[model samples]
Target: MPEGLPLSHAQEALWFLHQLAPDSSAHNTGVAVVIRSAIDLPALHRATDELARRHDLLRSTFAEADGRPVRLVGPDGLAGLEVLDRPGVSDAALRAAVEAALAEPFPLRERGAFRTVLVRRGPQDAVLLIASHHIASDATSHLVLLRDLLRSYEPAAAGGDPTLPPLPGTFDDHVGAERGFLASPRGAETELHWRRVCAGAAPAELPADRPRSAGTPFVGDVCRVEVDPEAAARLRAVAAESGVTEFAYLLGVFQGLLYRSTRQADFLIGCPTTTRLSSKTREVVGNFTNTLVLRANLARGSTFRAAAVSAAEQLRAGVAGIRYPFPLLASRVRLSGGAPLCRLTFNMLNATGSDPLLGLLLDTEHEDRVVPNAGLLLSSLPLPQLGGELDLMVNVRRSADALAVEFRYNANVFERETMRRLAGHFARAIAVAVAGPDSRIATARLWDTAEPARS
Candidate 1:
């Protein structure tokens, strides 16, 4: 939380990415959390206006007026917010209002890069809706924005002064760095490297479960899976016995799940990195995140535990070298310039604060705002907590009337009940390997389950 450092987060990283690839469509994603309180609407608007004024980045938008990307800094007058007052509205009605606002096509060719739709859910509840274009926002940013807005709201409450920091750098600085990098010698080498990596390698493509549409769709769903204390203890024991990172064991379990769900051995999955490599810009807020891909090579005879270990090794190395920007990688590996390398990103979010007011002054705070089309498999449950029960959320896309599922399982394949039963199966398989390194993955469960022992 110290402002003395120079490390950057995903927000700053994304800004740099946009500067490198202004036409990249994978940049949009944000979210809105409905907070219900008997707060004054006029006061809230004033606060929002004030908030926008305080942060230059929030006041700016991505633009291409002359066919060159530029920051469209917002006018102080237009920073005002509006709360749609709809009293006596049901949940369905509230949803309808949101849907209508979402349905409004984003005017990206215009000046600002984002939009806000404030709707009243009830006398006490209101929706602080944010609709930001992909190039300028993402989920992490959404959270930051919310935290700040709420903090700023308190001061805007009593007409008191809000404390805000002087931004050491702007989004433009990120773009400038990316631009310079892209034109440098390292940039050329990186592009060539990427071309070879992706060359002749088959793309991980998901078959459409339904009809394909050219229409821009934003369908999404969330599934929550928690690992309780008892199970987590077993997991820890197994991980220790196997001599691998807990994350590696978890990835192995996920690969098994993916194999069951998708029936594919190889997959391209992305996880997030904090991207704060140095101390100079540590507290500097912006998109400082990048994606590290895990390509699992599961085969018919591969044991679940082996897969986990393999995954762990890959992650350890990948996480260490995450300083490499993925946009640059795409250029390096010489993949199609327009298409992103990976689609399904397994984002293990690590941005939650230990202290709610970690680096905030009483006068100002930042909330988590989001970008368009963030990622799947994004969950943020801090490590080493609770009855071993940990929370995991599977986030997928859907505008409305869609569904998502979490394949739940205990650490025993036979005792598990899933169409694929991969999570349960892999857990048991890996646990055995942990308990006995040389044990076969197909061997019986190392631990008992709700079901009786298998013959």
Candidate 2:
């Protein structure tokens, strides 16, 4: 065993959070890629092994040493894939298998934080399960892993030498760089900005079906709704006219709903920002996700266009000032009895580079996630079982054709019907905003159970 290296500040915070509920799988995250083409099982196994070796974080385990978190880089052999042959398994069975894999928590001190499972349902159809501890991976890391796996598998499947590129740096090097920056003058300046931002932040809780638990649980449920291509196109037009990205428009709609839901004009919302500040860290796979808290103090009778423009400005600032670690910032803010600083999370994840990969034929590509209805099949996954740190997360993804939103909420605190109603309200809010960006958002008639539908 190699001597453990101290984890990045972000990783250390995640480690401490995971330790809070050692048995829960709330922090587990992964992606399941379904391939309907011929998969050379042996080649895939070798490819995964090589990929893990290339990225030290894939084989990273964690434990505490002298009161600080340390990452244990396990051997390459620890990153091998587990193949499960389920010839002619039913769709329900396949779903159950995927769920089981997702629910499996990592033994942080024992094994590496990554696992790969190949479930073969037939000769040509199989689902690849790639599970990783959130502390070890993030949204971009998932794409990086998939890109490398495919690149590695293509040649290995053909019995040829793989042409995988060398990673520019390792996760350890990232930790060292982060430490150096955090100790410098710029770090202190960033910390001060964070303190100022967080000092005004409070948990923006929504009305729930039931009271919150003393300690949050990871029990999760998802409700998905899609903005149809027509609606999406209209939104695009509105965004173009407003001179803001579609995300900013969607965010403005969400902020409008938040104002209505909470009835608080001044509240904080959390947005996830990537910490890959430079191209140097682009190819390196590790946890570089940062959570930024933005103030949503919408003015009464403000137009959605104005809100979106303001949101766009905040987003730019947030991205530019996201070098500070979120955990450390959260720690700096003093909450009442250790309460969370923010509750509602609104994330508009951009799905790029995966579409071309999907268009290739099964035999030539050797992988197929071809879906007749892209919105339903590519809907957002459930929220990260972050031990119910937040009551609700609005995860939106704008695919090639449609804009899909999944309201992932705590089952313990929300009923399915409540979420369904909320989803409807969100759709209405966006539809109204798309129709008239200049209209006052507060004046828009959001749906209520008692209010009859507009004729």
Candidate 3:
């Protein structure tokens, strides 16, 4: 057992946020799966126990050692599962139970950072809820955990050896690599690159419908933005013609939206980038995500195509410097009023060819076999509201045929109608830009009425 293990740079940033608001469940990352089949209770229990044994992060807690946060990995065989068999639970009741479980905060110094709850509704129906603090997991980790759980349950239920293959690497190994990188010459170069990129960039602030005061709690609400298949196809065609990926083109569109709404020519937007640079750490269940501050500079009288090309260039540069930690950059690059540098962020979760990690884990072969082996049918359940940390987070999920854009905004800062208007304007901007790629951004129609365009 390792002793006095330091938290990774990402974990340290989460720890600081946890300290600021200890009771907030905003940092929880989780997934819920509905099962429509008879389950083996004992086997599933054993599977959950095995999951804790396989990953040390599932049995870990945080504490202060000499005025610094350190991870304390506990012994194996920690049963993190809670089984609740309700014979006559309604759909609303089941949803309420899952929400309560997800909203429960973890006392970092006392209990483990993982939670598993099995709410059995009937003989052939159940919902499995798994959640962990962001310090211990990421979006990809949820898929990894689900994969391992099903792998362990199959053998345990059949009265055979339930042993699994050893992990490629541990989370501690990732931490060691990060520490070493920060001390290397490459790390210095990465930091210098970020310093220059963020030297004169102003904080990107969206116009809020309500007044924001100090010490507002981080409560949030989500609104859906619908994009038809035709629009999606047109957007993709425009992206290819512009010589940029769909992500870059969409990011440029978002920047154009901000420019039209707020008229900020130069600002920063937060972009989350993956840090699983090697196969060794790819399968490791930990926080392997880093935020990259992408600068969007729209010169006066520039076209939408020019904005996208600039975005592609800046995105290429930003990803190159992703090794520099956000918290460290926050300390070094001082902004006025102590505001967060990247207040508005853009994220894309594409079903095809966007996220390789998720695509690999939830591939057709694995997805087909996992549930049916237990005589189960996967059910669609509403995703849990795992709160937000930014004023506005625009997530674009691309499927095979259409794009689903969701805007998650702080309820304390903006109203629901405001988000709806923003979404409408976003759709309009895309249509205008793709229709006339050479038109001046200032001439793009944002509202129904015609006004004198700025030069």
Candidate 4:
């Protein structure tokens, strides 16, 4: 085997974050599935080992080489499958067990970044849990791993060969390409574009119910709300009429909420962008996410339409400069000590129509199969509770006729009731913005009465 490979820029940032909070499980990415059929344990184990062998990042550990972090791949890529039998266990107990397993920390320096557990509830019922450190996996990676795991399991279960497709490129090749880009003229231009875009932007100061104290832990909870079919349809229609993507329209509404709450005309909101530019890396399992700090400038007399248009423009510019490293941009802006460059993030996931993961779990096509030829019904388990690293994170999942919105916030910085109210405010903002796109952002109603007082 060859020597260790250098960590990518995204991996390096996650490595430092892990060092800062070694016990924090906020950076762990996980997914679970409830299998309605008796699983072949030995076959599943073999499939898992095959998955690790195929993806080097799954079998790799992070360590410092000459004061810089490097990925060291082991010879055997086995992340042993641990099976637990709990016959007649209550639903609450089963959930608790799965949560505990998901929250288990990974000693990335000594062990591989992947883990798996099987909780057998009965002869024909079980749950499969998969987790990996964010340094080695991401949202897209979870889907890739699941597809490959099941693809490998079917053959192993039948005592036949698993003919998986050849990987187009390895994680090491990605790292090399990233390094090459950073040294190229295009990379320099991209960095310059970001620097100019983020100039004079301050971290958003969302009015929290409680003030954050020094050394406060990064604990968080999620509050979810659903937009009615009528409202969701109106929102899509408005976005289409205004010649902007749904993401831009949603982001505009979020920016308006922040502006009304903080009364700040200019601030920053982080948006995660994928760094998988080439088709070769489409299925690669690693951290290929980069944060793009979108500057939301709501002028004094701007209307919601103007805000949405501005958001659309910024999104275009940001995606064009997505190749610029986030860590380098952070350092260039001297955003070291006080507060993070962006205190809020907004993400939009098209779940109902496009996302392959949700499509598989929900069987959106009514195909009656998660994995072809596998006679098992699979449903996605709720994601395990974990800490958050942001002041506020908003995620919107678009379905056929409705939009499901979830706000994940730091519990220490916000009360449950505050988050509830915030969720309501978000819904109202969307309704108002879509109903009257030209309404002045300042005059848009967020509360029945005056806004709540900031702490």
Most TM-score-accurate candidate: 4
Q: Largest lDDT belongs to which candidate?
A: 4
Which residue segments of model 2 deviate by more than 4 Å?
335-338, 352-355, 358-388, 448-455
Worst 10 residues of 3 by lDDT: 362-371
Better of 2 and 4 by TM-score: 4
- Ranking according to lDDT, highest score first: 4, 3, 2, 1
CA displacement after TM-score superposition, residue 60 of candidate 4 (Å): 0.7
Candidate 3 residue spans exceeding 4 A from truth: 353-375, 450-455
How would you encode candidate 4's per-residue C-alpha lDDT over 1-455 as one tens digit per residue? 24678988888988998888878788777788778777778788888888887888877888887788888888655576888888989978887888878888888988868888888899877888888888898878887888788889889888977657789988778889889988999988888888787776688877777887766777778898877667788988899998999999989888888888888888888998788889999988998888898998887688888889999998998898888878778867754255667878899977666555566553322333444234456766777446456888888877665687888889989999888888888888888889899998887776886755421
Against the reference, the lDDT scores of all candidates come to 0.49, 0.75, 0.79, 0.81
lDDT of 2 by residue, 1-455 (tens): 45689788889887887888777788888776676666777788878988888888887778777878898877788778988888888977976787688778788788868888877788766777778888899867876787688778878877887557787777778788789889999889888876776675566677777888777675888887876556777998899898989888888788878877777777778887787877788888889888887777686778888888878877777776688887787777876567676777888765543555333211111223454221112112222334346778888876655677878888899899889888888887888888888898777887865854332
Please give each candidate's TM-score: 0.66, 0.90, 0.92, 0.93
Candidate 4 yields a Cα-based lDDT of 0.81
lDDT of 2 at 173: 80
Question: What's the C-alpha lDDT at position 330 in model 4?
Answer: 82
Using TM-score as the yardstick, the better of models 3 and 4 is 4
* Model 1 lDDT tens row, 325-439: 7755654453443434664544332223343322211101122322211111111111111110111222211111221223321121112233233334444543454455443
